[model samples]
Target: PAPTAAPPEFLLNAPGTWNLPMRTALASLPRSVWLLGLVSFFNDTAGELIYPILPLYLASVLMAGPRVLGLIEGIAEATGSLLKLASGIGADRMRRSKPWIVAGYAVAGLSRPLLALAASWPVVLVLRFADRIGKGLRSAPRDALLGASVPAHQRGLAYGLHRACDNAGSVVGPLLAAALLARQTPLDQIFWWASVGSVLAVLLTLLIKEEPAPPRPSAPRPDWRPGALPPAFRRYLVVLGVFTLGNASNMFLLLKAKDAGMADYQIPLLWAVVSLVAAVFAAPLSALSDRVGRRRLISLGWAVYALFYLLLGLAGEGWMMWALFGFYGLFMAATEGAEKALVADLLPREQLGTGFGWFHLVSGLSLLPASLLFGSLWEAWSPLAAFGSSAALALLALVLLRRWVGLPAQDGR
Candidate 1:
């Protein structure tokens, strides 16, 4: 049976019932969505705890440089991106998403603890690679499960809530890292502590509910090739790819702050501020996209991204970097969920795993070039040159999106 598409009670006009209706609207979502949100929250908490300090650890402890960091992040994401396609196809074939989701989380969860023992950049690279393989394995099917668990009308809100939980963990993780650092915990200790959240995340996965996928032999096989997807999805991917090419790994942003004289302990706090703003705004902005339109919100988000990049290129002061990071968070809140919701809108349910696989694959594959190019440009010319080029690309993508993609007809839930 299809998930309920009944208009949410929040849309009702009854006076005095507003608060109750809002709660009811959220309560109506399938239990799986809520559990998955918690799962993402814990998983991201573990990941983000390790992420903010990674650049510092690599630079100060492991004696690696910026270019090496770029390679590691780029290769890690690309590795995961490649696996997303295979995992998505496998999910459809096995007629189950839970096993993939559990396996992916477990793999990633297991990999983080090993980072504590990493003594060289190459070792870190290999561990990060393994971690991302787990990410790639789960991402598409996880997204497809979220989409399948909701009705058409609620997709945006569902994804928005999920991102909010994910971002909230981002906020908590960094603050926790900062607190731990203040207490004089060694970086390795922090990495070891991160495994706690990873374990909880994997455990939470055991309770999630998934509707059975179509039987393997009877499942509709959408061609995995990009050319075979709906034309609108292809065009959407084109614009997305263009925008993504400019979006380098965020480690560069923390590096920017570090270069501007921020303390090592302060980097996590700065990262937390960014995630705090993103967590606060993600749901409202995404729900707004549901009412207004995904394209309009996405266009505006890209525009904000361009401006943030442009200013970030010029920021020379720590205060300026702090302010600009908050702006960057706003950019994330606007697009992260809306982008996925748009994908769900453009493709049929049967093909969702493949569609999302393509989505991650494009973004992931692009990160290699994007990060490498940005790092190269920063080293060869100046940070201004690299960031300015990214801004220009974002603006160009925004224009193409507005001109080429129109409102897509909504497919049924």
Candidate 2:
């Protein structure tokens, strides 16, 4: 008997089935989504080219230690987070997201070339701050735009695809750096070459057209305080704050890799492996959230984080470290997109920018204390204490999330 073909309508409408065909999933998105994804890809490429090397550079070249690394990342992210809150408000008032997006990318792009000239830790800190300032200005508005471009149902897939592109660039950037380093290229020269990707990313942003915001009656200005947001949204932010406290900068992980006997040139290769896994899995996992529910996927990702952090504390050999790093990418791929999509689900259309702003602010503000605490633990006790403590905190946060946060009304699951 010949098998009957399923109806096209069935494939298109079925829950959890949209992401099964990668090409079909992509074809369903708008042009703006693709453009924004490409923009992120190039932007991340430029950033990651320097990122994986930065800890090593500071440690070896400038003789900075782990605590200094924590301080720099904490300050940079905190500054960017503050600006993100401000920019989200500004984007809402101006009702023109593209300008903010362009300016932010341009600022960060312009700052990349200056790194080649950085001779001191303070100089690097200043440059890093400037780069984050650009990120702060653009992130919320850009996410708001992406959320607007896709339909309510497709938000997860859109964000997931965007993250996938970003991670893909992360993979490429390190591979490029590794190739150059293998040929004995100077770090400064690599930094100079990175500027090309930044330039290209900025140029691509010029072509992205914003979706026209729906018309609305003029009304009283809304409150900016976190208390004014819906109860569900506010509670979600609280859970995120809890989770982020356990989430220190990945630089610490790289530092751990080095301490575990991974060589300097091999560092970028290891970084690439993590990014490749993220790039491959990010979209599919995020798409699954669109069907299963964001909370479930996010919770699962945190569970994975807790598990790995515990194992990482026990890992000693180079192969064990590499395996841990590779699987750790799963945590990133699962959470990043689903988290944003959940934000979109929680907020009204007009408030998306501000909502995302507050979201980033909460995450960013907690990061300083998180990194400092992690670094302090490492310095005071041992790597085991640092990683183990993070794992415990992650589990606590997971419990809070499950008990306090209810599923959003729109989440069919």
Flag clash pairs in model 2: none
Q: How does model 1 fare in lDDT?
A: 0.86
**Residue pairs clashing, model 1:** none
Candidate 1 lDDT, tens digit per residue, 1-413?
Answer: 35546544345332112355545766787899899999999998989999999999999999987788889999999989999988877776565788889999999988887888999999999999999999998999999899888877787778988998999999999999999989989999899888889899889999987887644555456568777789989988888999989999999999988988898899999999889888877876776676777888898999999999889889888877788898899998889999999998888777788888889999999998999999988889988998999999999999988888655754211
The true-versus-predicted C-alpha distance at residue 405 of model 1, in Å, is: 2.3
lDDT minimum window of 10 residues, candidate 1: 9-18
Give the residue spans of candidate 1 off by over 4 A.
1-21, 214-220, 410-413
Cα lDDT of model 2 by residue, 1-413, tens digit: 11224312213233223444656767888898898899999998988888888988899889999899999999999999999988887887777789989999999998887988999999999999999999999999999888888776778889989998999999999988888888988888888878888998889999998867766678756456787777889988999999889888889999998898988888888988888888888877887787778988888999999999989888887778778888898888888999999998888777888899999999899989999999999999999999998898888888877788766765744
